[model samples]
Target chain A: MNTTVHEYRTGWKRALIETKISLTTPGDLMGFVMPTAIAIVVLLFMQGAEFEGAPVSLGAMNMPSLIGMNIVFGGITAMVGALAMDRTTGTLLRAKSMPGGMTGYLVGHLVSTAMFIAVTVIALLAVGLPLFDGLEFGTPDRWLMFLAVLVTGIVAALPIGAVLGALLDNPRNMGLVVFPIMGLVAVSGIFYPITALPGWLQAVGQVFPVYWMGLGMRHALLPDAAAAVEVGGSWRTATMFAVLALWAVASMALAPRLLRRMSRRESGSAVAARRADMQRDW
Target chain B: MGHPRPHDGPAIAVADLRMRYGDKDVLTGLDLEIEPGGVTALLGPNGAGKTTTIEILEGFRGRSGGRVSVLGVDPAHGDERWRARLGVVLQEWRDNGKWKVRDIVAHFAEYYKPYTDPWNADDLLDLVGLTAQGGQRVRTLSGGQRRRLDVALGIIGRPALLFLDEPTTGFDPHARREFHELIHRLTDLDGTTILLTTHDLDEAEKLAERILILAGGRIIADGSPDQLARAASTTAEVKWIQDGRLQIHATEDATDFVRKLLATDDGAVTDLEVHRASLEDAYLELVAQFEAGEAAAAVDTFQEATR
Candidate 1:
């Protein structure tokens, strides 16, 4: 086999090993389970509270939104966190020392991130299906749409996460990523309706991938009448896909250049310096 | 043992290499060369740019100026093929903490499959004396064990040249000796050109065929261990007790001075001792002089005095 192909194969193997390790590690496993647990508890608490002018209860409306928000969280935060931690730990330098190692390292992360999102999404649906009413997964089209939106959502968010990860020097500064994501979640209508927010806030939310991801999930899993609470009383499937695709293109275009720059700066001394800094912080 | 490849070119050659960090020059007009299959040690105090020079040769950092070639290719433009032929054991490695020793080593070996036949992970682990620790997590290994693993990873590709940057910094004496024995085994097994950097004079003497003393960003001294010791032993100190009084004298010729003292003392001299300047003393003096802001003068003086 060609060297590049072999390296990519090695990356896939790395992804498999890392995925297994993550699943077995209690802390990593809990990272996936805790959010789903919190979402479920939140969904239960909101049960029987009806939304104004919408046909479904608040719990039902939130089920799909929570799933949507989880995708963005899992895709973006996971990618960013992995890059920053690996860079600090000398994994990036180790990769650079080997032939075609960078390609393997990157492909491994991409695979693992995708798998993490898939597992999280499945877990949420399995738990949500038994507890929530008015969810529409009975048809093939709904399942297909849900799958498409989930995949596209991850694809759109990953490159943005990569860009952020490359730009940040310290993993301790993850609050910079977390705070904006929380704010985005609020404006993106993960818990309520975007129309309830100010017009400008709604416009701002629509400009990001978080809002489109949530809207896409609602269109896939919620009852048709649930569209009444949306901005224009329509699914806006075409617009949602267009916006998400555009974000994916823009981020993908920029991420490689930024990631290359970041990787190029990694050397043994850089890693050693980071280790010393971490010791001082501790 | 693998057969040594026929290559007439030097394993590493650098000319007028310069590195400036921000406004300060770390290395200025440094030059050195290492013959194939020869173990060379770069000895220097902290912040003497040893790490910078090694990193540039490993192609991990770009130099501000000058030419550097390792394995007959300029490091700045070295391709993956060039990278495959080189092994770098960095100063510190805390990566793969969650990975098992065997798994990490096996994973690394895969990268060399397309370039060259790599050592088997199991055999490599045993060679590094980590067979019992293969199942252990890397984070659980002691500092010495981790360094052994680092060496294993560095040589797994059967590299033509290996770079070990202060490989025994935190090792205990026992571990340090064992590590030295392992290096000797590697050199004997195959003619792998090894270039290591260290601040320890004894380690350089023990492991390297040639020692390059780098101070103030220049090669101030270069020779084998015996030659270095001889070059620095230009002065000797003699101590003796005569008529219940202690006497000490410094001289350029201890043998002649002792001969005259013994002849003139009429058998009164007792508790006599002669101490030749050790390499450690010379190394310390050279470093002290460089640190005292007379690096160029110190280099010139040492070279002139030694010659």
Candidate 2:
């Protein structure tokens, strides 16, 4: 009988429905699995290489790092793309017309995106475990750390994505966010150790969620001795979680304001204008 | 529900509604009122701000200045409970492409559960004529079928007031006819107050019980379809053959003219036809009259004539 209880329960159902949709729909399924497949291909090429005095092959080191990259892409870039697509398709305006529909919609996306990232990261780990010899994910404590890192990574990434998604009305402008993330991954040492990058680039990398999550994942799965090749020559575990938690807090505080502003401006004419611009631009 | 039924005043009341876009003024001192039931078609030329007016009422857009009340709540301040009482279907929508038709309907119906009992999803789909296409994905439906789905989603919450912006755009004759019947069924089921905007006068005449023709950002004619037709143009055109030649004449009194023609030249008149101006003609005349710098006089005259 309570309104908030009913709305949130419906939101939970929506998330389940959307998760099924993403799993079955070809375009959506491809968006989720394509990055993992590419990571496998890239790791295949790195199988023979090893970092100096590191405990595992370069491929094993890069495996969990790539999982971090998935969290960023699935949580940030993909979320932004979904928001932009929904705007052009009038889905957002449709939600605006319904009572408590916006609340349901936001909760649904958050839950569904988290599930997709979970599925993607698990798939990558399953595929990587047999291929890499030194992955330390078998221990119970390692699993706990994996769950912790993934949760904090999503918390850090999704809100920033929502904030950016609210700001970019045009889907064409999505490239503005995607390319920068791609550039950040390069400097963030997803495919290489942060110690190999220039000190300034490593410094730039350490400030963002992507590099911190990669470090957290490495701390979770890679043999602890592999920390010799990391920036601090030991897993700076506290700093990793603290940095991600800080990003999550900052983004969480700012996202709702931006999202409300964005939803307030959503009307039929606004959707029509965006569609018209898309057709013209395309 | 915090919002009890409020029917004493007009369902929608707008006074001095004004909208401006940068340098252009779309609506200037526009005022309107609609009672609780029946369909009212808002007719206006493009850029006359029919969409703007409807959006303002739907609480999707904020007005520059006006006193607007929809369902006894100012739309600018209309809350979630206020939104729960209204339904809106815009001209075009391509949403939820991956969701099945019936699934989407049943899914959206859940959002209204906090405020009101929603329509049964199966019955709603049948009413909107999407029963056969229930299992089909939304993106696969034809244009008419898609619009019917749009209507189904709009009213799933059993809204007391519904706003349809050009409900039937780009519909073939057959589809348009079916859509009109569905609209009739909706209004008859509950006295759901509906305000629709459309460019098709025939559709307006057929679906709406009352028609308000807006020109120059104001309602120039407001009455039933027949009244506006009669108010704007009373002169009927008469065509007849006399002495084996065709003759055409316009007269304010067609019955008298025809009687005189038959009395004076009964043998010579072989073919005769009388044509009264239709709603389309009256609509064009009113817009033209308003554009030629004599709108106030023309509208006043039509108001007097209609009265």
Highest DockQ: give the candidate number: 2
Please provide, for model 2 over A47-124, each residue's C-alpha lDDT reduced to its tens digit, 9 standing for 90 to 100.
889889987999989999988888977799867987899999999999889998888888888888988888878888
Two-chain DockQ for each candidate model: 0.59, 0.74
- Give Cα distance to truth, residue B113, candidate 1, Å: 0.8
Once superposed on the true structure, which residue ranges of model 2 sit more than 4 Å away at CA? B1-6, B238-249, B254-273, B285-307
lDDT score for residue A248 of model 1:
90
Can you tell me the DockQ of model 2? Answer: 0.74
Q: What is the Å distance of residue B91 in model 1 from its true position?
A: 1.3
Once model 1 is optimally superposed onto the true structure by TM-score, how far is the C-alpha of residue A135 displaced, in angstroms?
0.8
Cα deviation at B138, candidate 1, in Å, is 1.8
- Residue B200 CA error for candidate 2 (Å)? 0.6
Looking at model 2, residue B241 earns an lDDT score of 83
lDDT of 1 by residue, A1-282 (tens): 487889899999888878877877888989889877987898898987988988888898889988888888778888889888887888888889988888888888888888878887898898898798888899999999999999999898888899899998778778899899999999998899999999999999998989899999999999999999999998899999999999999999999999889888999999988878877998
Off by over 4 Å in 1: B1-7, B239-249, B256-272, B288-307
TM-score of model 1 (CA atoms): 0.95
Classify candidate 1 by CAPRI docking class: medium
For every model in order, what is the number of clashing pairs? Answer: 0, 0
lDDT of 1 by residue, B1-307 (tens): 1222445689999999999999988898899999889789999877788999999999989999998989889998988778888898998888878888999999989888888889999999989999999999899999889999999999988999999999998888999989998999889868689999998888999999999988777787899999988878878899999999999999899999999999999999999999887778778776777778777776676666565
